[model samples]
Every structure is written in C-alpha cells, then in structure tokens.
Target: MVDQRLPLASVSDFATWEPVLRLMLTDGTHRSAGRSARVAGRVSRYGWSLGHQGSLSSTRIAVEDIQRSLARGGVQEVAFSAEIQPDGRTTLGLVWPSPVVEPAVGYPDLGVLVLAEGSLPEPWLRRPDPVPGAMPAPSADLELLERTLRERLPDAIGATEEEISAAEARLGVPLSDELKVLYRVTRVGRGDDFEAADRAGEAVGCELFGLEHLSAVDAAQRHPGWKLGAKRAVRTGPGAAVQGLAGSPGWTCFGSNGGDEFAVDLTPGPAGHVGQIILVDHEQSLGAELVADSLTDFVLGRLREDGGDRRGDQLPAEARVGTGHLETIQAAAHPALEVLSVGPGDGTPYSLAPVAGLPRLRTLTASPGTLADALEVAGLPGLEFLELGAREWRVLLDAGAVPRTLKAAAITVRDERHLPVVPLANEILTLWNRPRIVQTLLYGDLGPGV
Candidate 1:
C-alpha cells in the first residue's frame, strides 16, 4: 500500500504517479535517490499497453518510447473516461469524460506508484513489434457471465423476459459471447459501483477504464502497470465485507453502451446486522455463480424458527427458499427474511402469490399473479409503489382490471407485446367523462403536474 502518511513533494507530486514509484525501485538507503530516473523507468515499463487491443502499434516499444519522451519533460495532460448507468434510465453511462495522466502510476495493493517528469505517456502510441505471439488470453463468455452475476445478485440483477427481448431487438446484432458475459457480470446482482484500473486491479477510484485501455492490457500480458483501485463494497452481514478484485477483468462492449447493477454479499460486518451490501462489479464474471450459490445456501437460515421476519436472528445459516417454502411462509407470523438480492437461484423463475391476512404490512412491491390476483391488492389501501414489470403488467392488462386504490405505478413494457390493452387515449377520454376526475395522464404525458 502506498504510504498514506508520507508527505508528497508538490501538488504535482500526487499527479505524476510515474515519479512517485522511484522511492521503492531499489532496496538500498539511497534507493529513493534517482526519483526522476525511476519515474522514466516505470513509464517505459508501463506505458506500452495503454490503448485498445488492435489499435496500438508496439506494446513494448511504446512503453519504452513514452518513458523516454517523459524524461525530456515536455508532456502535458492526460484524459480518462468511464461508464455509468443513469438513474431511472435503463441505459448504462460514463461519468468522467477524461482524466489527466502523469509519469508515476500508483499500484496501491502491490505498494508502488510510478512517477515521471514531463509529457504524459501513451501506451498505444508506438512502432510495431517484430516478434510473433501465441493464442489470446482466456475471456469468459457473456451469457454465462450474466447468469453467474445473477446468481450472486438476485434482486439487483433484474431482467424480465420482456426486457431481455428488447435488448436483443435494440442491438441490431447478437451480443458477442464476451460482451454478454461482461454485461451480466456488471449488472447481475446488487446496486453497487466498481473501480476501473489499468491491468492490475489497482486504481484511484471506480473510474471505469476505456475499452481501448482494457484491450491493450489483454493483448500484452506485460506492460506499464496501472492499478485498478478497490471496490467500495458495503458490509454484507453486520459489518463490511469489502472484497478487492484480482485484476482488471475483461470488459467487451460495442458502440455507445452503458448500464448498471448492484453487488451483494451475505457476510457479517462489524454491526450485528447483515446490512445491505452494495458494489458495482463492472468486470462481472460468468464464473461468479458458484460463489453466489454457495453464499445463498450459507446465509439462508434453517427452517422452523419463531416466525416474525426472523432475519434479525438469521446468523450464518444456509437455506434454499423454494416455491414450497412460500406456503410455509404464509403460516408464519411474518418470518424475518433476507432474500439474496441477485439473480434467480436454482434455475427457477420466482412466482409467488402473496397470502392475505397480514395486516401489519406497510408496503408490497412485487409482480404478483394474474390481473384477478393483483385486483385483490385493491384491498391494500396503503400500497405505496406498485412495480408492474413487463410480465405482470401483461397479466393485469389481460385480466381487464384497473386497480382502484393504486397510488403510483412503474410499468415495464417490451416493444413486441406492448400494444395497449385499452387505448391510452380512450382511457383518458373515459376518465374525462367522470365528474370527479380532476386529473389525468394520457400517453404518459401528464394533463398537469400536481
């Protein structure tokens, strides 16, 4: 770890990561003597693999050349950009358009930082290598990666059958096996954030690296080492269970794409509660399923507890909440529950019909059964937010029931089967016919904002 205590030389001291690493190049007392020389050396060692996979000319020579150029001290600014998922919007996003780069590259976990004097190094800018190479490194398939991510994140990794179809439709081309894997891993489970690093998983923060940066690193196993920082993981059980990734996992994306997903864990933290843990796994992996499943079983406390949402008592336990368990849940007096908020568990689609009689309920956010079953929810006068996702929305519209007491609704509709059950315009006209209908929403455009 970079000594958090050592006072840096100047404001530039912090910026030029290339030069900062000179302090550790050798083991002797004056090991920190040739700070400038070490900065150039680190730059030469790290800058080659900085751009996209096929974009860079010489991964090795590029590193050496950049280091030499930086030695002369003529470099100016470096830029960085990362992806993000906008709120309420399904599309993924990029937050930082760019960042300034310098000589020293900091590797927090390995306890090293690079420092250079002048111009920013370009890992991609170089002459071609005259050597031959072998097969490429192994990258996980996208679909499998998504499934694995879902296994880890049940609730946070949501995708109705309709949304999946919509995604396929919008892309115009089938999602590459690799891209799919990355998408699933990044957005599979809990709501969280991930940090972007060069090749090593060491970074300043969760600023996602660009595709070019990732590709170049994958192409060349060796290059200037940039640290992909640690993930800001929330505590799983009572306290925090922050797990750092090994390296910058492969991220394969296409033109203009971005999205978000949350990360979750059942581990206990400092407090006695298994609080909601959150992190963004941008480099989500397809192989995460085994880990996720094991966690779910470990955390699903045993059966036969004193009812009443016993999540408070749910210490390190393992369980499988099957459909059969739902009826047993009805028998309980509101058993405390800590449902893993990630992908579908045990390859089963979850469809539960909530039993009536629990008057203590204040909120019910679920996609229940057919329209008839949801109409029963009219009894829940206190219902806050009704999420009638694509599948359930179809059920309600098919049931021909318009909930009377529903306060607000967030509906999911796929372009394929999203034809209006009742013409939106006609519904508005009918509401206009009502004498007490003082407000209305037509075509999703409000008559007036209240």
Candidate 2:
C-alpha cells in the first residue's frame, strides 16, 4: 500500500487528482530515456496521455519542462503522479519505485499500483487520442542528435517561431515539419558532425546557414542574371520562386560553404526519395549525391557516420600551409581555424592572394612582403588578430591599408628605432588605442633618441 494521505483542503481537491503513467526506456550506449508511446496503450486500459496536461482532469505536467529535463539526458524511467492544486494549477510529483522497463515490454504491476487512496481502476479513467505535431515531441533519433549537438557546440540555439516563419517566407516554400522542429530545437552552424577540418586545415561538410544567411541568399537570388556557377538561375520572376517547390525535381538550398551548398531535392528521383538532402557543389560544377531521406535523418546520419562521437572541437586551432597555394588554403579553411600562416615557398605567388578566401580567419601570420602583395584584395571580414614585421605594419598604417576588423596585432620589430611614426586619424587612433591593442607585443628592444 503506497502512502495516499494528501494535504488537501477538502475531499473534492483529492477527487480531482489523477495518475498519469508513462513508460520510458534508456536506449543506445548513453542510456537516455524519454516518454514512450509504445507502452502507453498496454500499461493501462486507458490509452495514453499525450499532452503536458496529464489528462482531461486538472492534473498535468508541462511538456516543455519534460523536454528541457531530457535535453541533456540523465533521468531514466519515472512515474509522474499529478495532483490538482486548490487554485486549479497542476502539481506533478515523482512516484517512488519507478518501473524498470525495456522497450516493448509490458509491466502488469503498474495496472494495480495505487497512486492515491480511493483511486479508481485504470478502466474507469478517461483516455484521449494523442495529439500529433506537438512541441518537443521529436522522435528518439532526433532527440539524441539534439543532445549530441548541444553537448558538442556551445553556440547552437533554437530558432523562434517568428524566425522559422521569416525563413520560409523568404525562401518561398514550406519547410518540412522535421526541418522546422530541428531549427526550433537547434539553429544550425558549427556542430560536431557538420564541420571537419580537411588536410589543408579547412572546414569541410555542410555549413548550416541561419535565417540571416537565408535572407541574404533570397536577396541575391532576386537580382537579374544572378547565377550559381554554371547552374540555372534561381527563380526570381513573380510567383516563380515557389512554383516548382512542391513536386518539381529541383534543388532548394538551405545552407552553404562559400561556394557549395547543402540542398534538398523537392521531387523524388529514380533511386532518391522525395525531400532527400544532397550536397550541391557550385564551384566545381559537380552534381549532387543523395545524403539522407529527411532533414532529421541527414543530421543524425552524419553524426552516426563517425561512430557517434566525432567532435570538431577536437581539431587543431591553427593551420600552416605553403604560400600561393590557393586551392590548398581553400581546401583547409574551416570555422575552427583561428590562425593562418601564408608564406612564399616553391609555388608562384598568386596574382590574387588567397588569404581573403578564408571565411573564419582571425589571426593571419605572413611575411611583410607577402602581406603587402595582398593589400589590394578584400574578404578577410572576420580577421581580428594579425602578426607581421614592424616595417610591414608601418607600411600598412602609412598607406591606411589596415583593416578596421583587426583588433590585436603582434609586430616583430627587429629594430624599434627604425619604426616609422605615421599620422593616423582619430577613428584609426581610437581603434589602435583599444584595450586589445595594448596587449600587442612589440618584439625586440626599443631605443631612445640619445
């Protein structure tokens, strides 16, 4: 006999309370568990409790809370006994002696377990049909993928409903519920399975774009004659954007890696199913290959490809490659690359320097001569840290060539006495005087005019 005494104000309060039993199981190597619908019907004659609200009665549990708790994975199977408060709010308490269960296993003892005194038999309780497409109701595979991503990538965030709607409206197509739920749970960027550094230390794989990127792509596609490499122009005519979105065999891009993109095929192919994902390489003019059947499957399948534990965080922080190797440097560029060393070697210097091609380059280490050659080129938008010879730094400052994006610099001054004093505007001075600038190391000794 379980403790059934309630600190209720009246017998009516006790009568309003109800017991919602849900069977959960720990699966895979991690042993994570959430609500399982498989045993919902078998546990009791009353079908399954679907929503956060435990039942039609006042007793309930908020579905959002359950998702938050299960997001990181720890709590296993536990029974939630819901009681109605005097103010009409539902308060759920954990039941003792949680049913140790496996998937598809039936526990007969749960049918006879008493939640509260005078509780009626399971057959007497009301059972409602499960609501479909509820929030935080992701499948087991998606749930595990979400957990893995959250653990690996600290910057990942769930998208708001407004963000999702805006992205769909801009794309002129209805995003699948799976994709929406994925974005709602995790706005893609640099995730463990998504970004891996190649031989040149460049990030490879699908770089998942956010709503902002989608907006930019939308605007770019609308311009006349705008095209991606040799591929057909993105539909820009009135109503043409979404005309073939449903059944037409076309690629709809959602994310990109500067030149290539991760796209979804709207219509099915001979071997490919509808809504299948593929990698479209625009730069190489290469055709796409089937990646996954669905958006969720694509992400989960990628994570599973590396034995479920491949993390981009484990990659090296910096990469050093020979100078003038544009293809080599581009191949190695990844979101994780913070420092890049480009220098002169056996290869001929490119007429157009390759440093600007790296999307996430922060610190650039190059010979003063090498840096001078690339002064005309642009595209190091994320560069913040710089390392160069003092003479080269002075040359850039004299020519006003220093990018405003540079925050910290390390000048290797062989002779401080030879350092030139260049006139700088207040705006440039302010940037040079910033706190990060103070930390800049001026290597070698300084000589005073004596």
Candidate 3:
C-alpha cells in the first residue's frame, strides 16, 4: 500500500530504494545479479524491468512496495542505479523526467534529452537537396498507365479536373503526369462500395487512399524525438537511386502495404528516375525503398529489390565505435561523418582524435570512461548535439571547452556516483542560456552490499 502520510520528497531518499535494490541484487535472473559491479533498472506505471529481467515472482512483492512508495509521491516512472564502493559504502541513484524534457521528447524512454533552448539536430533540419536536372524513369508511360487502370477498373469514377487542381494548390506541388492520369482514371475512396475499393486496391497492388487523403511526406513527420532523431544522419550514397532523407515533399503517399505507404517519388535519388515509386516503411522515420522505376513498372510487377548491407571503406554518416561494432575510432572517421557514439568496452579507453575534425560531424555521445581523454571533445568543432557521461562532461566543463555549436545535449549515467547529474545538466543549459533541469537530491545510506 502507498504511504500517503509520508513526505513526498523521500522518494529521492535512499531509504525508499533499499528494499527494491535488495530484491534486484538478490533475485535478478542474471548470473551476475548479486555480485555484479552495478545494478540498474527502470520502474514505471507498467511495473518494472531491468536489462536482464522483469518482475520475477519472488521479487514482485518487494518491487511493488517501492513502486507504491513512488506512486504516492506522484512519480510515474523512475530510473535507479546502484553500486558498492570498493571501501563498502553502498549508494543508490534515481532519475525522472524534468519539466524541460517534456516537450523536447515524446517520452524519456531511452536517452534523456538535455535540450538547450528547444534546438533541433541537423537531420531534423535536413530537407531533400534540390535536383534540378532530374527526369522521369524510362519506364514511365502516362498513356499506358492511364489506359491500363481504365481497363482494370472500367466502371470506376475518377476525380474531377477541379479536384486535382485544388489538391495541387493545397499541397503546393504539382502532381506528376503519371499520378494525374491514375487519379483521372479512378480516384479511390473508402466508400460504401467495399468490393469496388478492394478491386481498386488489387489493381494498385496495395490499399489505395482516396484523392483527399494523399499527402506529401516530409522531415517533420519523421521526428521520433530529439534524443534519437537528433542522433540520426541522412546520407544518400553516391550510387543510391533514392535520396536519403527523413521525408520528402516530393514523396506523395497514395496507398498502403499494411502499415507502410506507397508513394510516387518526384524527387528521385542521385541515380534514380524522377517519378519512381518508393515504399515508405512505417517502422523507419528516415528514407524510402525504391519499389519501381515508374508507376507503370510497379503495376506490371517490375519491382526493384536491394540485397544485404551496403558497406564500403566510405564511412557512414552515422556510426558506433568501441567494442562490438567499429573497434577503433579510426574506422569510423570520415569527412561526411555526422553522428558518432562511443560505448563501454574492455581494455584501454578510446581517444576522440580520429573523429575530432570531421567537418560534418554534429553529434557525439561517449559513455562513462569510454574516452581516454574526455577533453579531446573540444577538437570536435561542429557538434550540435553532444552526450557524454557525467565525468566526461565534467572534464569538458572544468576546462571551459563545451562546444558552442551544441543545440541540444545529454549526459549518460552509469552508476550511483553519476546519479545526480542534474547540476551538471543545468550547467550545460547555462552555457546555452536555456532553462535548467530541476532536480531534488534524495540522500541516504543502504549500508554495505551483500
């Protein structure tokens, strides 16, 4: 049961977390549960979960107790991490969303956003570059496209010329010839005639939306959150047939393959045709898959298929280094590098030297102790969003070298020592003259870890 009589601020105190930690340290399913160097997990209205386990039956009761304590205190969700000092001093740390973090993120689900005055990352601001010389695919045939659709849906009703013109004016873009012809033959709608709409979908190879429902996809719609979206990099390879973008106004979505949308890509990739068909996957907020070189090809089942991971010596605009992926920073360094993240690993720490001067690099995230020299971040001149562990940021702060180009930032926490980094986060906001992250410190001792 929740203790309504108890003071609300005790949720930050160590006494509130001791029972939860005891169960976590003793009952976690992981082999390292009790003896591990540290323990961390998230608790919310959905109950609680750790990196390795959920609320195991044996620990459920105890877990609920702490959760109740927090609920009565008005906390919807909280993250806690704990570790025992080598000298045997046990400490616990807790974190929750601050007022500044609310609007900058959909939810503080993964990385917390320490936004600096509502700034956005580079990718969020990325629009498809103008391609003036682009042309339609050789497979394009407006006459054949219109004739074929009319043949399949002979009794269909098409959109009026006035409707098409109104759509163009409303969307502020002209419909490609192929698109106009398709609409002229049949403007699909979710009408009472389910059988007719289904037949139209079958002819279209996907569920078709009505003329009024068609909309151009663009970058704003792809924004997941500044924390994740800001870290993404859009790089259209030299040979790519589709322009890598968050979304494109030229991508006029007209149908759906379940959750994904089918669009006529008026703004093609560097090696693509102007009016190619592209599949905008619902799961991905960035880019589209080329379906066919033209609407004619799409209906004829002449679809494009790509195989396997596209890799080369040319570094991706975004990359992860340290341990499992790119072992060395040298492997990730590239002039086109836009986002770089460093994580924890064994052996010696990494240096930021290899990736320091990349002109396009805008994001940098180094986990606690991942960087050999934290101050080397000063060499990264173009960073607009930077995330580092508290200690790493401390090094940068002490040196007065926080990157001035940062639009938003974050601080990663690994253990109890780095638990209350709100003061540090506020200092980050101070540099940008932004509102501070409000934090209340709740201190207590849980004694020694067993």
Candidate 4:
C-alpha cells in the first residue's frame, strides 16, 4: 500500500490515469523501504502531487512529477526506470548508473525509480525496474568487492557500457545483481560524481578493503577455491602502484579468499621483493610443486643482483637444514638436498642441501627417523645444526658421536630425559660444555613443569 502519484500526458491521456500499471521496484521492498519512506516524506514536504488535468478532468499531472518528488526527498541511492503497461500501470527495474543505460538494467520500459541527482553525479540515468514480486538477485559481497577494486583501479568502475562489457568479456564473469543495485545507488555515470561509494552496500559491512564479506557460497558460485589463487592484479604504471604498510612488495590488493598464496624472493621479509614471483596455486596443486625451479631461479637472480653471499667460495662449510615443511621451506630446497632429520616420532621433517657451486654442504635435516639417525648425521665433519630431542640424545650417546664441530643447534625434549656424560675426555661433556654455539631452547609438553 505504498502511495505514489503520476501526471497525465494530456486531457486525452486520461486513459493512462488508471492504476492498471503494476509497480515494480528497482530495489525490492526490503531494500527500498527507507527510500520509499524518504521519498514519500519529501514529496509530502514539498506539497507535490500528480493527478489528472482539465479542472477535475483538466488539471492532470505528468510522470515527471514522480521523479521530482523522489529528487526532492533527497532519496538518491540507485537509479530506476518505469514501464507503462497497457493496463495503465508501470513496472520498475534497477540498474547501474553508468553513462549508458544497458549496463544499468538489461531491458528498457520495465519501470523507473526516481533518484536524487547530486547523490550520484555521474552522467547516468535511472534504471528500469523489474516486474512486481520478482525475487531480487543477490550480489551483496561482489558489490562491496567491486567498490574495493575501484578504489585500487579507478578506471574499472563507472566505465561506459562498451567499456564494462568489454572488461566483463575479458574477465569472463558476469556482474552480480547486488552490484547493479550498488552502481545505481551511488549516482555514478550521469553526473560529475561518478566515483562515489554506494552507501547502501557499505552500511551492511560490505567493504572495499577486506575479504571477510566474500563467503564460501559466493566464491563457490564465482571463482571457487581451486581457481581463485590465480587471479592477480598486474600493474605496469605509477597510477597502478599499490600502497601497503611498509615498502614490502605485498600488493595492497593481495589477499586470501580462505587458504593461502605464497610469494618468494631474495629479500629478508616473508614476502621477498628482489626477483620476486607469486605462487597463486595452493600447496595441494601440481603447479605449486612444479614451481621449485622458479624459486631456484629467483635465488640465482638474487645472487646475481646482490652478489658474493651465495657464491660457492663464500658460504659456510656447515650443512643447511629446515625445521618446517611449510611451502616457504619446500620452495627453498636445492638439488643436493641431504641430511634428513631422522629422529623418531617428533617434530616436522625438513631437508637441505648446498646450492651446487656454493661453499657449504656438510649437513641437512630431512626426516624425523630413529634416535640412531640423529647421531649418524651429527657425527659428520663440519656438523651444523642438529634438530633433536631427549630420545635422539640417548641414541647419539650410545653411538659414541657425542659432539664434533657442532656450532648451532635447536633441541626440543623433556628435561627429565637422561643426559649422556663423559668424565675423562668429557666425550659427551664437550657436547654440553661448548658454550660458544648459539643454542635455541625449544620446550616440549612434559605435562606440568617439574
């Protein structure tokens, strides 16, 4: 029972004054209620009404009055259109307020929803409304996502129909229904304020900055988890340069839809910038596994740019070892990957090797095997880091390879475990006595501290 008024074209246009026209809203009732009330209040405030003309028969108003009424209400959120039905009713539809009409609403003459002019100053027109009672389509998250995309790439949003259509064809995805409403509400193409943010979408936590709003449902329907990581924004100009905290090459636009994406480079940060590349594929993907050579190439490139450190003559003689199987470490391996951490049943497995033609290549961590494997590897010349526990210590003591030139180490085991002692030459004593080595203390869950 929402009230509305219309104008009569002429005295002869009396045939058009009847209510045979069915009302269709650009934004469905739930979305447009505030707008409807605001429009009604403004129209009432302005003392405006559209009725038939010719005295009682001559004093008729025009449909434009509806537009003026909405305009006066300060109700400019989305643009809408109206379709005149032969039954004397009008159907309305929603659209994105682009310079052209087709991108706003797909069809013409459905119905028109009036908009506030200054709200969306872009050179755009109102969108035609859908048929009455039609279910409004959903794009709640995408609308926000596009807003964010626009913030990063201003040229992409509010583009002309031909431009948007071309981009859509290129992207291979269609815009969502909610996104259309968002475009309309902001008053984009028709006026000077084409880049305005759609307040309606923003009110419901649909933001242009974070990925929290994008749901599994939306991702499933659009890109899905498997294909999502491959999507990246590539920029070739200063205007396209993304801003982020710290100068890290982490693109402000780079974000996870749920899982993870890896970036590798020569720099010290988690995201390496020098000779950088991205792995959009997840850990489970074959493409991810195949990218090892790419990482090595990056390392080589870094060595070439930075020089000396990675050269065969400069690296330390000790072996390289990894403690985690994370993608970062897996991507770090060289062909000579050796010295697996073979202690039984504890901690993550890691592998390491000398980047061929590099200096050091004495030890590495590969798997968590039995206690005996720990001593076997630790006894080797130029011993580096031995990631071990109480069990491995006992095995090493039993194997008589207590300590050698071992320099740095990370040990994680309960303190109660027996320590191998050497009294005379302090055979095992040298292992505990050498204080120069950088010892990293790692704790194990021994229930409660003794």
Q: Which has the greatest TM-score?
A: 3
Task: Please give the TM-score that candidate 1 achieves against the real structure.
Answer: 0.22
- Candidate 1 residue lDDT tens string, 308-380: 1112332112112334332222233242321211122344444333333334332333432323344554544
lDDT per residue, candidate 2, 147-260, as tens digits? 555554445467789988887787676666555655665565443243421210121135566544542112222211101111121111221111211112235676665675
lDDT of 4 by residue, 101-181 (tens): 111122221111111112211101111111223221121244454455445444433434554455336434343333332
Rank list by TM-score: 3, 2, 1, 4
**TM-score of model 3 vs. true structure:** 0.82
Q: Which 10-residue window of candidate 4 scores lowest in summed lDDT? A: 36-45
Model 3 segments beyond 4 Å from truth? 1-19, 27-38, 52-55, 58-76, 82-93, 102-110, 190-193, 307-316, 319-321, 324-333, 343-356, 370-372, 416-418, 440-450
- The local distance difference test score of each candidate is 0.26, 0.38, 0.73, 0.27
Candidate 3 CA-lDDT value: 0.73
- Model 1: how far residue 389 lies from native, Å: 10
TM-score of each: 0.22, 0.26, 0.82, 0.22
Worst 10-residue lDDT window for candidate 2 reads 436-445
What lDDT score goes with residue 332 in model 4? 36
Q: Where is model 1 more than 4 Å wrong at Cα?
A: 1-236, 239-269, 272-325, 328-374, 387-416, 420-450
Q: Answer with 3 or 4, whichever has the higher TM-score.
A: 3
* Residue range 253-332, candidate 3, lDDT tens digits: 98998898999988887788888898887778777888889989987778887711243343578788877888888988
Residue 357 in candidate 4 has what lDDT? 28
Give each model's clash number: 83, 7, 0, 67
